[model samples]
Target: MPIIQFQLIPHTTQDGLPYQHLRFQITTEDGLMEPQDLKGLKLPENVQWSQGIVIEGKGPIWLYGYLVHECHPSSWVGCYDPRLGIVVVSSHTHAVKVGNVLPIQLPA
Candidate 1:
């Protein structure tokens, strides 16, 4: 299962809003219960919850995690330039999987 979390960004808009991020993490966490067992999981109690973006959609998040473990670098994400590799990493946190195809952008 992915470790869900958020990052804080300062807003420069008129009202200075708080930008909250949702991370359906594909972390280096050693072992997790099967995706089926995450249990329609509502996020935990007393943890920081985002009021910024509402996540909506139906799809396999954890299953995508499984597929990343099997795909190649350029197959999933279109861009895989070696020269841009370092630049790409600086842009986002790399997906921690058993393979090279980084899943930086998650399923919507």
Candidate 2:
């Protein structure tokens, strides 16, 4: 399995509301895949979006907001098979910066 590196980028909306942009990169046998950015994901209020997390197959990865969210939502960002080196983000957006240095486990 490849290493999935995740980052949360802080940004301000036009209305001045604070939110985070989620970005990730895959490190596979070939090399580091291009970073993928996922915008407009509604994260939980308790999550601190300043740090990055890495998921290395210790178990399944789960996302949450008010409820348990899907990791690959059809509307936000599509599902990708990291082994194939194919990255899929929404057609309207492009990949953003690399993530933070901290390594933490994603919420189960």
Candidate 2 displacement at residue 53 in angstroms: 14
Worst 10 residues of 1 by lDDT: 84-93
In angstroms, how far off is 45's CA in candidate 1? 3.5
Once superposed on the true structure, which residue ranges of model 1 sit more than 4 Å away at CA? 1-16, 27-34, 40-50, 54-108
Q: For model 2, how does the per-residue alpha-carbon lDDT over 14-88 read when each residue is reduced to its tens digit?
A: 334333344444445553333231234333344443322122222133322211233333222322233531122
lDDT (C-alpha, whole model) for all candidates: 0.29, 0.31
Please, what are the lDDT tens digits per residue for candidate 1 over residues 1-108? 334332222221123323222223333364344566444544323322322221212235564343223222221212222332111111111332222332223222
Clashes of 1: 0
> Which candidate number would show the highest TM-score if scored against the true structure?
2
Whole-model lDDT, model 1: 0.29
